[model samples]
Target: MHSQNNDKKIIKKFNESESLVINEFDKSGIISFAQKDVSNSFLRGTSNDFIEESTLYWTMKFNKYANDFFKKLTSDKYNFNQGMLKVFKNDMYEENNSKNYLLINSADDIKEMTNCHLIPILKNIIHAPKEDMGLLAESLVHMTLLKRKFSIDQEETVGGAIVVVIISKSDGFIWKEKKQYYSNESNKHLEYVNYYKSQ
Candidate 1:
């Protein structure tokens, strides 16, 4: 979280830019001027409108922070080997209970994913189907950060890690610790990275 002074600075910057306006929303919290558009829209006045407005507002407000954090995190090791981003679909069935996983390992796929905008990536994860494992989308984003945090020597044991994001239907979104392990038979190591969800 940013300090009160920093928050004031951010507000001032936004005020100067005139691209958006932010103000407290009747003691609830600060809301963006863009939210007024949603409030007046015809989406049955549902919470979905609020969610979409909030997501867009915050994404716009904090996108630069996320990008700067990414840059600071990855500037030192541009050539490090990165783990593959994987998506899994969990089918809660009796007979065909096998978990199917999608391996996003192609060079083009990897490049596009790594370079894409963060907001859409997060929105996709947040709105993904129950079986689609959109919750795990964040793991892919964290892989870039983790690769820079941990040393190459430490990663050798895992041969590379697979980042998976998991979202629970009823519990809302939460972050969890990264899991790392090595497979002796395959001579590979895997780091399962995740965001730290508050308890």
Candidate 2:
């Protein structure tokens, strides 16, 4: 029994260390995007200017599996099959129970939603390896989109938006902007992209 318990503890420790390493790598990708310049204008101006001037801010690497998972999460098929729409409606209702809930359409909207609402939602939804790092990256993507005045029809679609921003390994840093609409049938609304250059 003692030996079995020791073995279990050792395995658990190893798993925890592996999780930490993966989380670090995921965080490094976000840091890389944050450090790199989004445009020549960004280089000349202060950080605040870069935030204000750039339509699409920066791109970061995402784990391919996580990216794919996020895409599926936004798909109409997933929402329908999982009954996520009902869940989303409930979540929004709960959020607005005390006050009016408005569609996220601007930077101010995003700031208000994220600071008060979105963080907890992401934390609840994103449960996997490097969950905290993933939450931060997703939050940044949402903030960038809202800052650029991209319309996110519903809060539930935020995961899909994050997938749209995920940078592939082959593509180095690049800068581009375009409107993204959710391909999923459930939420056919204008999606925002800050810098989709990498994708």
Candidate 3:
């Protein structure tokens, strides 16, 4: 471990607060709209006191997914979509918990789909016309969402959140922390996709 410690001496000098943030991924997803329910106390503000459904974030996972989505988002030749993005007015979602599925299939729905890219996953929370909470961008989040879609046999969808990455002082990012962590370019791909971009 001595050699490992010696080689990573430069890491100590790297700025921890100097990390970069970008809004390109959300834009690239073409999620152009955001809706919120604020008449009641249902919509959890970013004060850390409320716990809404959270898609756990991490570094390696989010970056790779965001980077890939960014690439595809920029490529306009392909008509990418998040299938049917069920927009909810926070209060409407709360009142009709039993009928949540109703909000999903609107009369104006352009399509019916189970999967899309990462943009709607976020824009559903941080919509426009309000102060950007900047929460997701602030923290280094790595995640792997194990999807359990609802079937006729099962009436629930359980998405398991995993923070499978830890930002290393020595190595910038890794899938998981170990004795020796060196940044590998190829293995840097993050898996944040819930469903593949369906054709």
Candidate 4:
């Protein structure tokens, strides 16, 4: 996890979950944000009731990060719904039984799930890994299969390595751009890109 000290960023990287932690410097405001940089558009819908909004934002961010990572390199891991970004405010969804995919609208309800996270129950992943136990290998294979079908991690059995690389680079660029935006916060959205950097 990442935290801040005297305003400088502190980074903590995790290999198991590919998760990162960043802090706000006060020490306790630590959130579970991913490695991707947070933007003002993040606060776009953040309202007086921030809990739900933040939860939704977190969920959407992960989906978008995953989607964008595969897309930048023209990798096949880009899941189909990612292309739907132009038309919707969010792009996360889940499926129930066969032939019926339920679109998840409640972002804060972690229990309901996006419905996408239910692979082991909905689909049997029995033969995923040849080098490990059936369950772990099966699960990995299942996830890898999704990554493959999504066209995320190609060129190896991992399924989504390339996507992660793409997300990291894009996120870094985003941080640079975000820093520029905060440097000049008074400007309107249309031309903040140029004016923000000047300050």
Query: Per-prediction TM-score, please?
Result: 0.19, 0.19, 0.16, 0.17
Comparison by TM-score, 2 against 3, better one: 2
lDDT of 4 by residue, 10-118 (tens): 1111111212212223222112232211211121222212433444355446556756754563555554565465333222322221211211323224323322333
Scored by lDDT, the top model is 2
Which tens-of-lDDT digit does each residue in 1-199 have in candidate 1?
2233433343344323322312223211112233222222221122333433443355345545644655554565564322211111112121121221111122223324323432343345445664354333333234434544575644323225454434454533433333322233543221221223222
What tens digits encode model 2's per-residue C-alpha lDDT throughout 42-158? 221223233222312211111234345655776877545456754664564455332322211222332343234323433443353443544455555665445445545433322
Tens digit per residue, CA lDDT, model 3, 1-199: 0122321232222211112211345442211111111111111222111211121122224435645655565466666552321222334334433332322232112111111223254456445421122233112111111112423544333344433443434435644424334434543542222124232
For candidate 3, the lDDT comes to: 0.28
- Give the backbone clash total of model 1: 6
Model 2 accuracy (lDDT, Cα): 0.35
Give the Å shift of residue 131 in candidate 4.
Answer: 14
What residue pairs clash in candidate 3, if any at all?
A: 57-141, 57-142, 58-141, 58-142, 59-141, 59-142, 82-116
Among the numbered candidates, top TM-score falls to: 2
| Each prediction's number of clashing residue pairs | 6, 2, 7, 10
